[model samples]
Target: MSAQPPTPPHMTVDEFLVWASERPGRHELINGEVVSQSAERAAHWKVKLAVHVALLNAVRAGGLNCHVVPDGATVRIDDATAYEPNALVYCGEEAAPSALTVDNPVIIVEVLSPSTGRMDRARKLADYFRLPSLAHYLIVDSNEPLVIHHRRQEGCDILTRIIREGATLLDPPGLEVVVAEIYGAS
Candidate 1:
């Protein structure tokens, strides 16, 4: 008897969630495949911390009922795709009680790393913009004080801004965070 080739493993979104929950480390579901994420560098962590703190502070200062979450909090893109953003904010009823994952995120931030920069800029960018509640997608550079802010406008056009310094107003949530504050230089 001739041996046949092994069948490629495929998992549904529900299966991936159940399987990933029992495993260690970080993993992302893309196109029905589980992909392990690499360990983040020091620079990446620093920038992520700054962004997380800034968002939390903004929510507190503004007295908004928004919740700021760091990495490990999954944001479901669809049935077969989920991502753990560097930072995210969920306001009002979108904030889950158990805090498992967020379905409606107002802002999602990603600190770009060399390994994931390409995917983050292209694939992730396209995927994240699909979230109807998403108002801003901030891609921060860990090596420099640069922030690529993508804000959805009146229509479908996204207003892109590259901020090295200064501040940008987040309209829907009505919070103003300076570029320096996000980089931990302020």
Candidate 2:
């Protein structure tokens, strides 16, 4: 008897949303498969919270038409993929408090954990840059006082900077926060 061909388990974006909502924890759709995000450590949480607060403060202080959101809100990368960044900044008239997903994010932040470090730095980085509205992608290291900032330049070019002790400036959205502020007593 010939073995039957294995059925594909891939899911579309709509199907992923339905499938993921029934599950208990945070999930992402990558390559048409559901991926559960790792539970963060206390240090990780601290950094994440700090980053959110800093960005929020910046937006408030500058009176910019931008909003900072935590991980619960998803960003649709394509028909087969979506991600919930640790924190994100969305601009323009489309940002609403009631929205569950954001399609245009100006800034995306991720707190690096050992479990997801490689993926965050590699695959996720590539996926996020695909969004035209994305200007900066910050990877904060919880283990050290460091942040890797990837700033999008004109016409497909990108500028990268590593911040250890000084502040990193995020233009287009107009925000500046020191690297130490992100670790914030964690």
Candidate 3:
């Protein structure tokens, strides 16, 4: 196999954003460092598309203020931080003027691939919690058709629920995915 070109050592969020926007691979900024994701394999795309399809349908049907984005947006958290979660629900009013950084989002979903599973399940979950409006952080595993998450509880944050492949609940907009969908055609 040919050697992949070397990526720059690091980049400021703005520089990284500009650079990523100009190119094609999946990339996200964390603490002033630019991290590029591997080109997803077929299985990876399957799970991502499955969940996004569910979310998109529900959000649109509900007529909710939130917007559904596929490969959504890269939000600038601060000069030193920016991230683009795979699928995010940006709820609430988008007033006449809004800032680049969305301090709140009702939900954020990170579908895991072999290369990114660890960070997405831990480091990334922690960051998502920092958003006050983040009520649900869904970690959809490609290997297992499961929606694991830290769901907000009755007045508190808790990892209280596991929406397995067979279950369905209406957080809002009312869409459901059978865990089997995540496992693909196995």
Point to the candidate with the largest lDDT: 2
Q: TM-score of every model?
A: 0.91, 0.90, 0.77
The CA lDDT at 63 in model 2 is 91
Residue-level lDDT of model 1, residues 1-186, one tens digit each, is 666433227666667777777777888888888888899899998899999888888888888988888998888888888888889998886554665578889999999998889988889888999999999998999999999999999888999999999988787798877887876565
> Model 2: per-residue lDDT, tens digit, 1-186?
667443238987777777776566898889898787888899988889989998888888889998889888888999999998899998888566566689889999999999989999999899999999999999989888999999999888889898888788888789887776776643
- Backbone clashes in model 2, listed as residue pairs: none
Model 3 vs truth, CA RMSD:
4.3
Candidates ranked by lDDT: 2, 1, 3
Once fitted onto the true fold, the runs of candidate 3 whose alpha carbons sit more than 4 angstroms away are 1-10, 93-103, 154-156, 168-186
Candidate 3, residues 1-186: lDDT per residue as tens digits?
Answer: 667556567778767766776666778888867787788887777888887777776676667777655564765556766777777777767623423345566777888888888998778777777666677778887766678867766665566467665645547434454565555444
lDDT of 1: 0.85
